[model samples]
Target chain A: MDAVLSIRDLAVEFKTDTGLTRALVDVGFDVPRGEVTAIVGESGSGKSVTANCIMRLIQPPGRIVAGTIEFAPERALSSEGQAPRAPRLRAPPFDIVSLPNRDPRLQELHGGLISMVFQEPMTALSPVYTVGNQVAEAILCHRDVSRRQAWRESAEMLERVGLDDIERRMRMYPFEFSGGMRQRVVIAMALVCHPEVLICDEPTTALDVTIQAEILTLIKDLQRDLGNSVIFITHDLGVVAQIADQVVVMYQGRVLEIGTVRQVLKDPVHPYTRGLLAAIPGLAPKGQPLATIGSVVGDADIETPHPLRRLADGRQVSMPQDSRG
Target chain B: MRSYLVSRVLGMVPTLAVISVIIFTVIQLPEGDIVSSTLDRLQAQGVDVTEEYVQNLRAQYNLDKPLVLQYFYWAGNFLTGDMGYSYLFSRPVNELVWERLGYTLSITVSALFFTWIVALPIGIYSAVRQYSIGDYVMTSIALVGLATPPFLLALIFMHIGFEWFGVSTGGLFSPEFEDAAWSWARFADLLAHLWLPMIIVGMGSAAFTMRILRANLLDELNKPYVVTARAKGVPPAKLVLKYPVRIAINPFISNIGLMLPGLVSGEALVSLVMGLPTIGPLLLQSLLNQDMFLAGSLLMWLAILTVVGILLSDLLLAWVDPRIRFE
Candidate 1:
């Protein structure tokens, strides 16, 4: 599979007054080109941090101590196409870690080459800006267009995102729209620039159960239509099974399993993966409480001391390919 | 928009009416008034203090009437622009007030203008570089600004001005310009003398405003939308102005109602120290001497500013914050 992005031996730490706490250690994953790569981990497993790190959006007190996020050459990224244009991509991958926070290169990539959709739609949108203004602003940031043109394009994007009555809705604010509609607006903004990679940081976690399905379908449909790679960060195993082409199970900032969704779900290897799969109630026997990770690994085992540091010191422990695959 | 303006203007009537009653009644609620004080002053000067003369004076001044009747009499004449006579100045209250009002507005409004112009950029910079050395220095200066009293600052500036510039540092205009006719030279002299007082009055308020803006902007800068905006490749300056500035300014804009009242009485104590012929000290003197018309009219003006300021702030908030789909 063509890797659009590669994260190698990623280690990040948060320095508080008390001491340093490792948030992500020896975390590595490849987001395959034109596919949804799901990183499933509970809160504090650094799934969200991984996405933020890719965008170089990590703020103070938390720093990426060791890692290199290599983004594929921009030449391969088409400005416009149904499928990503198959041009000969000759330029070397850009090292995202080395770029300064406000470097023009990084700014160009952000919202232009690589965009992100956040989890909470309520706070994600600025209250002072209209739906159309925000989307148009994103376009105006990267594409040099007059305000009128940007707005027209934004309206088209809104219509594309399943928001009808475009002209009126464009002028409306976030509070005017329902949660589902707001999320769609955010989606339109992220896709407006036709970014090559869209980071979905638990995009539907704050959504209603019914609306969540619609958003997920919308994202999948858009990814297909736009031909952009997606890094879907979530803790829902069911969501992973449904949406992800490749799955990476992370626990305590360490990658436990990485393979196709079917391989990991049907024939799991890692003990943590087995426990997580078994914890699903549907897979359990009838007339009994669901088996949980705490039951399988025990409470003490889940917090296994330095499970991340056990392998090659400061080197990636990329798992082998399955013979079945 | 028209309805909003109509409602706001319509809303001011009852408010001003209530304030008028309170203004008249509160002055009387106090034990002694202009007559008693005048009587006291007369007796202190060893003049013949007589019940008969006191009765005559009270009757002449309409003080013998009921409080409600007194209020109606004052309100009736006031509504017709005859703002009673200021016995203290021996002139009509309307003439006394409007004359002093120009001097007061020049200082207070300029102070306000200076405050906003200086405070906004400093506040923005402090928030953007929070915890940096520049932020620390700016924060320290803002704290000093807040802690130092405006009157104390005025006194210090006066001493410095006299010692350094050999110029008398009190009042709105230089000696030659005080009663000079409106001329280029007089205007120039006023400009030379006006800045010191403006700085003294404005420094305290500007620093206060800066700190508020800084704290509020810091809170907003860390918000999700700010990060989202940054992610959209928005330049750093535009990102800050677009998202955090607009949100942070809600509190600042809301403060306009309070600040507008300050335009009248912002540095009453400071203006007193500077000996500037502003209305603030005049308001105090009128209250002390029980110059009912002058004090009441001034108080009414303040109330009007407050009501109007609040209405303006609400309208401005609706304009700035798109979230308010004001029906």
Candidate 2:
């Protein structure tokens, strides 16, 4: 299978007054085309940071130290014989770490190829502008559309995201909309460009359970229609079980396991993965007390006498990834 | 909405009445009485001044009545738009003050326009480039502007202009102002004379305004929405202008209400230093010689400006931002 996006040996570091704090280390994973890939990890496990790195959103003092992120060149038109095409050929799978931020190809990747939906819907929108105007603004910025066409497209997108009274609500400010509506508006904005990849950073964490279900379902349906890869970042195993086809378990900043949902669920490989599965109360055997993972998250020390080393069985037995990374 | 407007206008009535009463009562005070000043001046000139002559002079000026009665008489004429005569200027109070009001407003308003134009971008840029050397230098200049008073700044500007730019310190227009047609050259001359006063007042207030805007923009930049926009793959320039500036500038627009009073007060001081015929020098002269009508007329104008300024700000808030509903 062709991997749409592949990340290898991805390490991220942040400079602080104390010292360099490694946020992500040796992170490796691949997202195939038209699939929902879930990065399952608790907060501070660099789940959000990994997504941000993909979108080039890491602020100052935090940066990708070493990594290779290769994305397939998005084909604008199928080559029929030797017909002439646009002068700018699509960017081939290149190391995102080495790409200059201001490069023209990099510029095209942003907002054009990848769009992000943040967790909090209320804070994600421009408060001064009407919800409709803001979505239309994003469309106008990315697409070659007239103002009238942009507005119409924005309204249709809002409706597609399951918003009721899209026209009336479009004129309303974010404060006027409910939490679910705001999230829908955000989704509409991100999907309006019909990007090749959509990175949802804890998209449903702040939402209530019912709204969470709706948002997740809407995202799944949108993905099916748009045929774009979705990277879902969340810590809840339940959410991963419901929506994720392939799961990448991250402990601290390292990927612990990468496999199909059933493989990881039925036969967990890593000890940490086993512990996480055992810790789930409902997943335990009937009438028996729920087993709890003994080790605390983020408790691993990086400077201990010995790091986790491979065992003789060739099983690579070691402590879980260090949270201090 | 109509009721709200009516209530706001009605509230101003009591305030205006109180202000008028205070002005009228203070002018009718026994110390430095109109009759006494006239009699003293006549005696000093070696003319035989009598109580009857002084009393007749008081009657002509309507200073013979009780303070309350005289206040009503003046208030009655005032509501009818009769500002009475200015004993000092020898012209009608409204005529003299209104004529100068145009000149004062022209310079003060132009300076205010410049202040916003210069401050908004500078302040936003400084905040966006926070901790950079450019930000540091801009902030330092703003602090200096804040530290110097408008009049003092005006004095310095006047000195500099006279010494270096060969700019005139007196008159908005040149000596041939009456003869000159309304041409670009004439307008340019008027603006040249305005430079010293404009810089003095504009820089003083614009510094504070810039600081306020910078603080506001910085606060907005820290907001999660701005981060969201950046993470959404919006270009840096678009992200800064669309989300940060649009959000941060709301508070600054709201603050226009407070800035109005400062504008009126600053106009006086800036006009005084520039030797422009604005309410500042006019009010100053009235206060020195105790010309009550001139002072009262100017004070009322200031009060009116305060009300109008706040109303304009509210309307602008509505126009620029749809989130704010008047109801």
**Which model scores highest in DockQ?**
1
Q: Tell me how many clashing residue pairs each candidate has.
A: 0, 1
Q: What is the interface RMSD of candidate 2, in Å?
A: 1.9
CAPRI rating of model 2: acceptable
Per-residue alpha-carbon lDDT of candidate 1 for residues B109-205, written as tens digits (9 for 90 to 100): 7888888998999999999999899999999999998898888998888898799989778887777678889999988887887788788888988
- Candidate 1 at residue B217, lDDT? 93
Give the lowest summed-lDDT range of ten residues in model 1 chain A.
Answer: A308-317
- Stretches of candidate 2 exceeding 4 Å from the true structure: A77-91, A281-325, B1-30, B165-167, B178-188
In model 1, pairs of residues that clash are none
- Candidate with maximal lDDT: 1
At residue A94, candidate 2 shows an lDDT of 70
True contacts kept of 1: 0.84
Interface CA RMSD of each prediction in angstroms:
0.9, 1.9
TM-score of each: 0.92, 0.89
lDDT string for model 2 (B128-209, tens) is 8989999999999999989988878778777886899896676687877735887888878778677666666678779988
